[model samples]
Target: MIRFENVSVTYDGAYEPAVQDIDFTVPEGELTLLVGPSGTGKSTVLGAVSGLVPHFTGGTLRGRVTVAGRDTRTHKPRELADVVGTVGQDPLSHFVTDTVEDELAYGMESLGLAPDVMRRRVEETLDLLGLNELRDRPIATLSGGQQQRVAIGSVLTPHPKVLVLDEPTSALDPAAAEEVLAVLQRLVHDLGTTVLMAEHRLERVVHYADRVVLLPSSGARPVLGTPPEVMAVSPVYPPVVDLGRLAGWSPLPLTIRDARRSAGELRERLADIAPVNGRLPHGDTSPRKDPNPRPEVPAPRRFLRRRTTRTAPDTSTPHPAAAVTALAVHRDRVEALRHVELTVTPGETVALMGRNGAGKSTLLAALVGLVEPTRGSVRVGGAVPHRAAPRDLVQRVGLVPQEPRDLLYADTVAAECAAADRDAGAAEGSCRALVSELLPGVGDDTHPRDLSEGQRLALALAVVLTARPPLLLLDEPTRGLDYAAKARLVSILRALAAEGHAIVLATHDVELAAEIAHRVVVLADGEVVADGPTADVVVASPSFAPQVTKVLAPQRWLTVSQVREALSS
Candidate 1:
C-alpha cells in the first residue's frame, strides 16, 4: 500500500534531517505498527504518506514516498484523500464540523459525492464505529472516544485503501481504546484496509499488530521485525517487554497473559526465592519513594493492605468522596461536558480515562471553571467552581494541561513557578525552593523553553504542585516524559494523595494509570460507564481495562502493589 525508498526529510530549520536514509514498505492489507520514543519522527513518516511533510509542513524531501502506487510528491492531501485516511494524536485540533453526523460526513461531502451516496455511507459509518446513538449529538459534546471515532469514521467513508494513525489511542482510556482498536481490527479483517499506525501505548496494540517497526531516535534507520524481535532491541519498551528481555525467555511473551501462561515455572522458582518488591528487583529504575541513596537488592514494596491480611469492604453502597461535581463547557461550539457528576475524596486519586477527544480535558478545565459549563454547575471542595474567585480557584485547583508548554510562558523555570506562587498569594521566593526540590538543577537561569520535553513537564508539574492545592487536576502529564520522569510524577501524586488531597489525572498511558490511581473511572460518549476502586473499575470491564489489569483479571491485580498482595495471599 505504501513505500519509503531511501527517504530523507530535512526541515527548513538549520538542523539535520529528521529521518535519514529510511527504506520501508507497508504491505497491502497488513497492519503495521510504528513504535519509538518522542521526536523519532514517526509522525513525520505519516506526514510523508499523507503529503503533510512537504505539502503542508515546510521541508526539503529526497527519495520517494508513494501511497497506493501514487507518489505523494505529485499528490496533495486532497488528491490522496481517496487512497489514504490519517488521524493524529490530538483529536480536538483536527475537527472541522460541529455535530457528530456532519463531522463524519465532511470528507464524503468534500469529495462531492451524491446526496444519497453520502447518506448511506454516513449511516453505515455511524453504525460501524458505534456512533449511531451519538449521531445527533454535538461534536464538541461527544467524549474523547466518540470524537476520535468520528474522526476515523469521516476518513473511512472515503473507502480509502490505507489508514494512517498517529497515536490515535494516546488520550483514550483503556476501554475506549479497545473499542477503537476493535473497530480498526474489523476494518483490516473485514474490509481489507491496510493500516500504518504510530503509537506510544504499545501494549494495547502489540498483540494485534501484524508487524512492528522501531524508529531510531538518532535518525539513522528504522528497525523492522516481529513484535518480540523489535521490542527486544528497542531501548524504549514497556515493562513486560523489558521483563521478557531480562528473563531470557525464548519466544518471549507478547502479552501479560502469554507471560502468565508460561510463568508457572518462574513463579514457582521466584516464590521460593522470596517476593521481588519495592521496584523490580533487577531492572532499570531509580529509587522512586526513597531518595538520597539507592538500594542494591530491592524487594517489592510491601502492600499497605495485604489481600490475605484483609477482608473486602462491605459491598452495599458506593463510598461518597469529597470531590467536585464538574460542569464541562468549552469554546462556543464545543460543549464537552453537560452537567456531569464526578467526585474525588480526601486521600484518593481518581484517574480520568477516555479517548483523545473525550471530555476528560474539558472536565478538568471545568473543575476550575477554566472553560465553564454553559448550563450546569461545578463544585470543588464544597463550593461551586464559578462561585470561587479566580485567586481562590488557583489556591484550590492546580491543572497541568496535555501540552505543558501551554501552562508555561516564563523565560526561566524558576520564574514560571514564581508566577504560579503569585497566583496562590504566596511568597514568590518560595517557588525556586519548591521547583528545585521537585526537579533538581532547575533554576532561575535555565530557560524553560530550552529544556527537554521531560524537563519541561517536570517544571510545569512543580509549578502547579507548589500551590499544594486541595484539588489537583492533571491532563496527560505523561506525554513526552521518559520512564523515570513518569515514575517521579507518579511518586509525587502518590504523596499528595497520602496527604489528604484529592487528585484527578487524565491519561491514555495505562501502565502509569495502573501505578498511580487509587480509583479509576471510564468515560465513553461523555457518560460514566464504569467507576470503582482501581482494581474493580479496571478489571470489571476487560475490553476497556488496561492490558496489565486484563492479563491478571479474575486474579485481580491492578498494580505491582496488588501483584505483591496476590503473591502473599
Candidate 2:
C-alpha cells in the first residue's frame, strides 16, 4: 500500500540528509513497524509516507514515495487525506477540536462525508477505541493515554486505507497499549487496512508487526525483513528479545508466551538463584517493611489513610529533603489524590506506577509545585513547593513533565541547551554535553520541535538535570525512549541518586522500574495502593511485572540482566 523507492530527505540547513536511499514497501493490509535508535530518521521515514517530509516539513525529497498508488511527491497531505491518515508523535498538535466526539468527527467533516456516514463512523470509532464514556469530555482534560486514544480515534473515523502512526503507544499504559495494538490488528485483519508505524516501545508492538523496517543510523540504508530476522541484529529491541539472545534461543521469541515456552530449562537452572534485595519467589506478596531502624512519622491530623507505608525517618533531621503529609488534591470535583503520606530522603529513587488516570502525573506535579494540594502540605527541601518562587524551586527541585515540549522553547537545540545552562547558572556547554551523552548524532542546529519524541525527551531531561537540584521529578521519562536510550537514562539517574539527589519518577514503563527504581510506589484512584521495595512490588503485580519476571515467574527475577548474571555465575 505504501512504497518508498530510493527516497532521501534532506532538511533545510541540515548538514547531511535525514535519511538516504531508503527503499522499502509496506504491503497492503499489513502492519509495518519502523524502528531505530534516537535521531535515526524513523520519523522522517513516517513523514515521507504521509507526504509531510518535504511538503509541510520544508525538506527536500529526492525520490518517490507512493501511498495507495498516489505519488506523495505530486500530492500534498491534504490531497492524500482520503487515502492516508497520519498521527504525529505529539497528540496535542493533531487535534483541531476540544471535545473527544468533535475531534473524532472533525476529520470526517473535512472529508465531506454524508451526515449519516459521519455519525455512524464516529459512533463506531468511539466504540472501537473504547472511548464511549469519554466521548463528551474535553480533550485537554484527559490523561496522556486517553488523549492518545482520542487522537487515534479521530484518524480512524476517516476510514483511510493507510495509517501512518509515530509512537502511537508511548503515552499509553501496557494494557491500553495492548488495546490500541489489538485495534490495529483488527483493522489489518478484518478490514485489510495498511499501517506504517514508528515506535520506540518495541516491546509493546514488536510481536504484532507483520514486518520490520530498521534504520540503523542517520543517512544509512534500511533493513527490511521478518521481525526475528531483523531483531536478531537490530540494536534496539525489547527485553524479551534480549532474553532470547541471552539464552541462544532459536528464531528469537517475539512474545512473552513464546519466551516462556522456551524458558523451562533456564528457569530450572536458576531455580535456586535469589532475586535482589530478598524478594520472595511467588510467595509472600505483601509490602516489604522499611529496612532502616528509623522511627516512622504518624499520619497528619484529620487524614484518613486509604493506604500507608512506614516512611523511614530523616536520619539527618531538622530538614527532610522532600515530604508529603496527608496530601489531598482535588480537580474539578474529582479527587486526584487523597491523604497521601510520602517521603524521600537524599539518594533515593522512587517509581510511581499505576493504571491510566491513577494520579501518577498529579503526584509528580505536586512535588514540583505545579499542582497545589487541596489539603495538607508538600515540602521540598524545607520549603512548600507550591508557594516557593520559580527561581527557588529550580534550586530545590526540577520536574521534567510528561510533555517534553513544555520545557523547550528555543528554535534550535543548541539555543535551548544554552538557555538551560543560563537558567540553572551552570557552566557553559554543560547542558549541551549532557544532551550529547543522552542523545548522540542529533545536530545542534536542528530545531527541538523537529526532533523525534524520544530526542525531544532527551533534550528536556538534559535541561532538567542541568540544575542538579536536590530533588528531581520525572513524569513518564521513558515514554518514547528505546532500550538503549533508556539504559543511558538509568545510568544517569543511578549516578544522580548515588550523588545524593532524591528522585521521583511517575512512569508506566515496568522494565525501567526494574532497572533503576530503588523503591516502587503504586497509586490507584488518587491513593497509594502499594509501596514497597522494587522486587516485591513488581514481582507481586503480574500486570506490572517485567518480561523476564513473567517468563521466569515463581523465581522472582526482575530483569534479563539479573537472569544473565545468575546464569553466568
Candidate 3:
C-alpha cells in the first residue's frame, strides 16, 4: 500500500539530505514501524509518504513515493487526501475546530463526503477511540492524550487506505496507549488498512507491528525485517529487548509474556537479591536495602522499643522553606486541582503521575507561575511563584513545558543558547555546553525549528538548566527521547538533585518514573489519590509499573540495569 523507491529529502539550507536513498515497501493491511535515534529522519520519511516533504515543508524529494498506487511526486497532499491520512507529532496544530465532535468531522467535511457517510464514520470513530464521553467537550480543555486521540480520530474519519502517524502514543498513559494501539490493530486486521507509525516509546507498540523499518544513523540506508531481526541491531529498543539482550536469549522477546515464559530461572536467581531503585551508579554492588528497614531483633521486641522511644523523629517532615498548603486551581469551572498539598525539601525528586486530565500539568504550571492557583498557597524557595518577577523567578524555578517549542524562539541553536546565557547571567557558553552534554549530535549551527522532537526538548531543557534554579519543573520530559537520551537526562537530573536542586516532573513514562523519581504522587479527578515512596505507589498500580517489574512480578525490580546488577552480583 505504501512504497518508497530511492527517495531522498533535503531541506533548503540543510548541510545534508535529511533522508537519503530510502527504499521500502509496506504491504496493505500491515503495520510498519519506523524507528531510529533522534534526528535520523523518521519524521522525514513519514512526511514523504503523505507528500508533505516538498509540498508543505519546502524540502526537495528526489525519488518516487506512492500511497495506494498514487505517486506522491505528481499528487499534492490535498490531491491524495482520500487515500492517505497523516497525523503529525503535534496534535494541537492539526485541530481546526473547538469541540471534539467538530474536530473529528472537520476532515470529512474537507473531503466532501456524503453527509450520511460522514455522520456514520464520525460516530464509528468516536466509539472506536472511546471519545464518546468527550464528544462535546472543547478541544482546548482536553488533556494532551485526549487531543492526540482526537487528532487520530479526525484522520480516521476520512476512511483512507493508508494511515501515517508520528509518535501517536507519546502523550498517552499506558491504558490509553493500549486503547489507541488496539484501534490501530483492528484497522489493520479487520478493515485491511495500512498503518505506518514512528514512535520513541517502542515498549508500547513494537509487539503489535507486523514488520519493522530500521533507519540507521547519519542517513544510512534503511533495514527491514521482522521485529526481532531489526531490534537486534537497533540502537534504541524496548525494555523487553534489553532484558533479552542481558539474558543472552536466542530470539529477543518484544513483549512481557514472551519474556516471562523464558524468565523462570532468571526470576529464581533474582529472588534472593533485592531490587535497586534510584540512580545506582556503576561499581556499586551493594544490594538495595528495603525502604522500610527493620532491626535484627524480633518484630515484637522492635515494636516495643519503637513504642517506648518517641517514634524516632518523623522523617517525613516537609521542608519549611518550600511547601504547599491547601492548593487549588480551577479553570473554566472545572477543578484542575483541589485541596492539594505537597512539599519538597532540597535535593528531592518527585514524580507526579495520573491519567489524562488528572491535574498533573496544572500542578507543574502552578510551580512555575504559568497558572495561578484558585485557593490556598504554593511556596517555592520562600516566594510565591505567581507573584515573582522574571529575574527572581529564573533563579527560583524553571519549567521545561510539554511543548518545548513554547520555550524556544531563536533561529539557531547557538542563538538560543546565547539568549539563555544572557537571560540567566551565566557564562557565555554555559547553555551551549549543557546542550552538547544532553544532545551531542545536534550542531550549534542547526536551526532550533529543524531539530527533532527529542532534540528540541533537550535544547529547551539546556536553556532552562543554564539558570541553575533551586527548583526544576518538567512536564513529560521524556516524550520523544530514546533510552540512551533518557539515561543522559536521568544522570543530569540526578546530578542536579545532588547539587541541592529540587526536581518535579509530571510524566506518563512509567519506566522513567521508576528510574529517577524518589517519590510518586498519583492524582485523579483533581485530587491526590495516592502519595508515597516510588516503589509503594508504582508497584501497586499495574498500569504504572515498568516492563521489568511486570516480568519480575511480586518483586520490586524497576529497570534492566537493576536486574543485570543482581545477576552479576
Candidate 4:
C-alpha cells in the first residue's frame, strides 16, 4: 500500500540529506516498524509518506512516495486525508479542538463524514483506546499520555486505510501502550488497515510488527527484513534480544514469552548466582551486592510505617533531601494527587511509576514547585518548595519536565548552555561539557528547536545537571532516547548519585527504572500503591516489569547488565 522509490530528503540547511536512497514497500494490511537511533530520518520518512516532507516542512524531495495508489507529491496532506492519517511525535501540536470528544470527531468532520457515522466512529475509538472516561476532559488538562491517546483517536475516527505514527506509545504506560498496540493490531488484522510506525521504545512494539525497516544512521540506506532478521544485526534492539545474544540463542527473541522459552538452559546456568540489584560498570567483576540495601519489609507495610511515623521526628536522623507528607493536589476540580508520601535522601535514586493519569507527574510538579499542594506539605532541602526563594530553589532542586522544550528558550545550543551556566552560577563550560557528554554530535550553533526529540531531551537534562542541585527530578527522561543514549544518561545519573545527589524520575520506561533506580515507588489514582526495593516492587507487578525480569522470572534479575554480571561470575 506504501512504496518509496529511490527517496531522498534534504532540508534547506547546507548539510547532508536527512535521508538518502530510502526505497521500501509496505504491503497492504501489514504493520511496518521503522527502527533506528535518534536523528536517522525516521520522522522524515514518515512525513514523506503523509506528503508533509517538502510540502509543509520546506524540504527537497528527490524521489517519489506513493501511498494507496496516489502519489504524495501530487496530493497534499489535506487531499490525502481520506486515506491517510498521520500522528506526529508531539501530540499537543496535533490537536485542534478543546475536549477529548471534540478532538476525536474533528478529523471526521474535516472529512465531511455523516454526523451519525462520525459519532459512531468516535465512540468506537474512545472505547478502543480506553478513553471513554476522559472523553469529556479538556485536551489541555489531560496528561501527556492521555493527550497522545486523544491524538491517535482523532486520526483513527476517520477510518483511514493507512496510518503513519511517530512514537505512538512513547508517553503511554505499559498497559496503555499495549492497548494502543493491540488496537493497531486489530486494525491491521481484522480491518486490513496499513500502518507505518516509527518508535524508539523497541521493547514495547518490536513483537507486534509484521516487518521491520532498519535505518542504520543519518543519510544511510535502509535495511528491510523480518523482525528477528533485522534485530539480529540491528544496532538498536530490546533487552530480550540483547539477552538472547548474550546467551547465544539461535534466533533472537523479540517477546518475553519467546525469551523465557529459550531461557531454560540459561536459567540453569544462572540458578546458582544472584543478580545484582543495580547497574554495574562494564568489565567490573566485583562481588554482586545490593548497592542500595533496604530492610526486608513488604511494600504495603513499609508505606504504612512511613505514614504512621511521619508525625514524630527523630533529631538524630539526617534530614532528607526532599520529602512529601500527605500531599494532595487538585487541578480543574480533579484530584491529581492525594495523600501522597515520598522522601528522597542524598545518593538515592527513586523511580515514580504508574498509569497515564496516575499522579506521577503531579508529584514531580509538587517537588519542583510547579504545582501547589492542595493539602499537606512538600519540603525540599528544609524549605517548602512552593515558598522557597527562586535563587535558593535553584541551588536546592532542579527539574527536567516532560516537555523538554519548556526548559529551553535560546536561539542556539551554545547560548542555552551558557544561559544555564549563568543561571546556575556554574563554570562557563560546565553545561556545554554536560551536553557534549550526553549528546556528542549536537553542534553548538544548532538551534535547540532544530534538534530531534532525543537531542532536545539531552540538552534539557544537561541544563538541569549544570546546577548540581542537591535534588533532581526528571519526568519521562528516556522518552526520546535510544539504547546507547539511555546508557550514557544512566552512567551520568549514576555518577551524580555517587556524588550525593538525590534523584527522582517519573517514567514509563521500565527498563530504565531497572537499570538505575535504587528504589521503585508506584502510584495509582493519586496515591502511592507500592514502595520498596526495585527488585521487590517491579518483579511482583505484571504491568511494570522489564523484559529481563519477565524473561528471568522466579529469579529476581531486573536488567540484562545484572544477568551478564551473574553469568560472567
**Residue-wise C-alpha lDDT for candidate 4, range 391-469, written one tens digit per residue:** 7788889999999999999999999999998898877787887787677778899998898888899899889877778
Every candidate's lDDT: 0.70, 0.83, 0.84, 0.86
Best by lDDT: 4
Angstrom error of the Cα, residue 290, model 2: value is 10
Residue 82 accuracy (lDDT) in model 1: 83
- Write the number of the candidate with greater TM-score, choosing between 2 and 3: 3
Better of 1 and 2 by TM-score: 2
Per-residue alpha-carbon lDDT of candidate 3 for residues 1-569, written as tens digits (9 for 90 to 100):
99999998999987799899899999999999999887788899999889888899996899899888889888999998999998999999899999999999998899788999988998999999889989999999988888999999999999889999999999998888999999999999999999999999999999999999999886668999999999999999999899999988878899999998988888888777775444422122375444511111111222122222111212233443257789999988688999999987666678999998899999888988888989999998789989999888897889999999999999899999999999988878878877876777778888888787888998999899788777889999998887778877787776666545678999999988877787889999889999887778888888998898888887778788777766776
**Over the stretch 1-569, how does candidate 1's per-residue lDDT look in tens digits?**
89999998997752688887879898988899988876677878889989988998878889999998999888998899888888876677778988888988888888888999889998988877778878888876665556677787888887789999987776565666777788889888888899999876677788779898888877657899988888878867666665455456677778877876765554554343322234321112464322111112221132212122222222233332234444545565555555567766655678887655566777787777666567666677656676778777776778888777788988877678668778766665555655665667655777876565566777777677666676778887776564555666676665555445577888777677667675678776566666765556656665445544454434444444434443445
Model 2, 1-569: lDDT tens per residue?
88889988899888798889899888889999999887788888989888887889897899899988999989999999999998987899999998999999999999899999999998999888889988888888788988999999999999999999999988887788888999999999999999999988888899899999999874568889999999998999999999999999998999989999999989888877664343221123375453311111222221212112223223354355789999999987578899998988777788999887889988888898988889989999889988998887887899999999999999998999999988987788878877877777777898997776778888998898777787889989987777776776776776666446788998889988887777899988889989987878888886789888888887778777776666776
Pull out the clashing pairs in model 4. none
Best by TM-score: 4
TM-score of 2: 0.90
